[model samples]
Target chain A: MFYREAGQFKSTYQTDQAIFPIVQDRWFMALVFIVAFVVIPLVADEYWHQAIIIPFLILALAAIGLNILTGYAGLVSLGTGAFMAVGAYSTYKMSTAFPDLNIIIIFLLSGVFAAMVGMVFGAPSLRIKGFYLAVATLAAQFFILWVFNKVEWFFNYSPSGTITAPPRELFGVLVTGPEASPVARYYVCLVFLVVFAFAAKNMARGRLGRSWMAIRDMDIAAEIIGIRPLQTKLSAFGISSFYCGVAGALYIFCWLGSAETEAFDILNVSFPVLFMVIIGGLGSVLGAILGAAFITLMPIFLTNAPPMIGIHLAADLQKHIEEIILGLMIITFLIVEPAGFNRLWQIAKEKIRKWPFPY
Target chain B: MSAEPTVGRKIGDVILDVANVSLSFGGVRALNGVSFDVNEGEVRAIIGPNGAGKSSMLNCINGFYKPTEGMITFKGESHHQMETYESASQGIARTFQNIALFKGMTTLDNIMTGRNLQMKKNFLWQALYFGPALKEELENREVVEKVIDFLEIESIRKTVVGRLPYGLQKRVELARALAAEPDMLLLDEPMAGMNHEEKEDMCRYILDVNDEFGTTIVLIEHDMSVVMDISDRVVVLDYGEKIADGTPDEVRANQRVVDAYLGVQHD
Candidate 1:
């Protein structure tokens, strides 16, 4: 009943076009802010921060990136893992080359690098579409990883054939390397998530967002209507890669501490991010985060739940079962509600709007 | 027809002139040496039987299909072939025969996209979505709402065009075109599948657009009554050729056009 918007009347287009137009939605968002910033840090344990929450936030950012391209822009990309590596490796090089520079600036600059690479790969989209385009991006996935793996310069000539994120500080707080506390890293990831999430939402609802959706829905019509297909599609690639690149940097510096190319393997990073977008909901910022949370926590739940119930299974067997269940869930969601968890949430809200009666 | 005078409305000099245009696909000719001109602020109609290349003519005009030969002059700038997006940049907008709307978006958003050319904020400002970006968005929304009100589609502004009925979808497509504030509008089969009431409503909207905005209209329609009533002039095409071009009454009386619509006796 409290979810109703019966009394609110928008007197101006500004109020009507506000992200959260309803008063209730604005209050709910404020409450969520307080919980994320204040309550979670106070109540949650270190394991939750380290093993679950931090990774969830970072992956959510990556999912947002994919959602922008594949979801909003109607372009398919399977090279997210490689795009993330672009961010991680570039950050590695930058932090080492300019040790005194702030990590935040490094992250932003790393994103720009990834955006450029993304545009290079995205050039083929102008000539190809659908499965052909997916294949093209898949080539990007393999090609980018191969380049990073082969090039000694990318890893700073590390014998291990990996890039390690050097310790970095943001405003005097240690937020990277082994010495950084889980809370500090969590805060860093959280700040990036909140700010980018806001920005993503802004882009999704504005003119650029409309153009992306236009290209996705009907390219011929979009072209006839004057939306430049090349520019719009490239922008999606550039922006999406920018987001994934930042997330990748955060993945190494804020969460993983150190990583090999294997950490960004297609099965490991790319597929999971794609699954999160599909299961969470495409074309929705909140959906991207929700999907990331679901995919991130499911594995942890599978490993812990059975042992707690005194029904312990072999580790490998548990892993296989988790994969099967995830596969099944994806199939079911595709058939049942392809819009993913976001649509479910929307339906629930719609129900709440008409609570205590079915009409 | 209702007694609406043309005293204040001025039909000015030629806005679009198609000179000796021909289009072909492989060995098949679609439009063969068809030529016509549209005056500013007048409703012009192109009518023909099925397979008469009426739509092909529209496609050529809007730069979707480059003519194999001939020149199209819009606002006195002549070109051998026009680019697809160049039409919009040059103040020409159109709807498709198949109702090509952005199905995933709401009616309002679809229309708002028409104002994309007018919106000046860059992507950086769009990302921030505050200060100037928000101000620009609101200003554009006001304009879109005016279009929504004009088309009497306010009730369905938030409804996705994909789920709307066929007639409403057609109206939304028209609204999207009008959102551009085009100097000329090209409508292909606007009232093709509508019932009598819906067709009446569409005719009223099309006439209002021409009357109020002074937008030059070049429409390809099948309804002969509607063509004869609203169009200031009509051009008839038959089997990839121009059969007749004159005022609606004059074309209706032409012997070749009568033969094109009704069968001609073999010699």
Candidate 2:
């Protein structure tokens, strides 16, 4: 009943076109912002900040990126982990090269490098589609990680084949490396996620977003209507990669603190991120974050809740059970609601609009 | 007799000329030696049998398919085949035989995408969606809204095209094409599968589009009555060849067209 838009009429195109046209939605969003920025920072402990909140924000960012390509643009990509690695490694090289430069700038610049690589892989989508396109991106995944693994320059010639995020300060608050507090790292990840998510929402609602959807829904019609397929597909790839790159940088600098190629392998970073995109809902920024939350918390819930129930299981068995449940959940979601959590949320909103009486 | 008056609108010179066009896919011929011209501000129709290559001719005109042999001159520029974007940029828009709307998007967005060529703001502006980008989007939305209003689809503005009924889906497709504000429109069997009421509505819209906007129209239709009523001139195709080309009355009386349509016996 509270989600009604009955009296809040839009007076102009600008008002009508506003992302949250309904007053209730805007208010809800404001409440969410308050809780995320103010309440969480004030109350959350180190474990919550480090293990759950920070990773969720960063993975949500990455999921949004993949959603751009796979969901909106209709390009199936399996190389999200690689794109994130591009961000992580490029940020590593840039920060190490210029220690005095702002770490935030390094993060953004790393995204640019990832965007370039993404566009290169995205070119095959013009001639190929569906599973073929996914295979092409899979090639990107393996190739990018392999490059980072073999090339000493990428890891800054580290003896251990691992790159660690050096300590960095933002506005004199330590935000990275061993000495940085979890609170500082949490704030940094939160701010980056908020800004990038806002930008992603903006682009997805604009002409660029329309072009991507047009390409996704009907490429031939899109091409005939003057939307260049090559440019649109590449832009989706580039922007998606840019977001992933930033997320990768955050994954390393703010969350992981240190990473090797193993961290970004197909099974680890790529599949999990893809799962987040799928479970969250394709083509929705909110879905990406929701999917990230669900995926991130599911394992934590599994690991902790079992002990309380006196159902003691081996760590390895728990891990296997988690995989089985995740697989089953993916299948269930695909069969029941291919649109995932976003569509369900929309359905709920629609139901709320007609509450107390069936329409 | 023309149903609508030509007041304030004169059928000018030929804007599109397809001269001896032939298209072949491997050894199978889709179109063979077909030639036609569309006069500016005139409703030109291409009526043919099922395999007579009507869609192929429309496809060839809009640069969806390259003709194997012939030159297509649009606004005096001649080419073997027009590129898709080039044709779109040149103010040529078309509706498909099957509804080809973006099913996932709302009706408003599907129409808004028709303004893709017109939206010139850069990605940075789009990413931010402020100032120039927002202004451009609202401006284009106005244009798209006018189209939605013209088609009388204001009620279903937010409804996804996939869920719309067949007749409304066709109307939405027309809205998308009209959103481009093209100089010429190539409609392939627009009235196909529509009920009598829907067909009547479609015919009125087509006549209005041509009369109000002065857009040259080249359409392919199976309905003989519709072809006769709105078309300024009709071209009949048979076995990928142009057998008749004239006004509807003249083409209706042509012996070859009658033979093609009614199917004459062979020796």
Q: After superposition, how far is residue A89 of candidate 1 from its true place, in Å?
A: 0.5
lDDT of 1 by residue, A245-309 (tens): 99999999888888888899999999999999989998889999999999999888877888889
Tell me which residue pairs clash in candidate 2.
none
Error of 2 at B4 (Å): 5.2
Best by lDDT: 1
Cα lDDT of model 2 overall?
0.91
Docking class of 1: high
DockQ value for model 2: 0.85
Q: Which lDDT tens digits does candidate 2 get at residues B144-213?
A: 9999989999999999899999999999999999999999999989999999999999999998899899
Task: List per-prediction Cα lDDT, in the order shown.
Answer: 0.92, 0.91
- Candidate 1 per-residue lDDT, tens place, B1-267, comes to 432435567799999999999999999999999999999998999999999999999888888899999999999999888778888989999999999999999999999999999888988899999899999999899889999999999999999899999999999999999999999999999999899999999999998898898999999998888888889989999999999999887887789988888355222
Query: What TM-score is obtained by chain A of candidate 1?
Result: 0.98
Misplaced by over 4 Å in model 2 are B1-6, B262-267
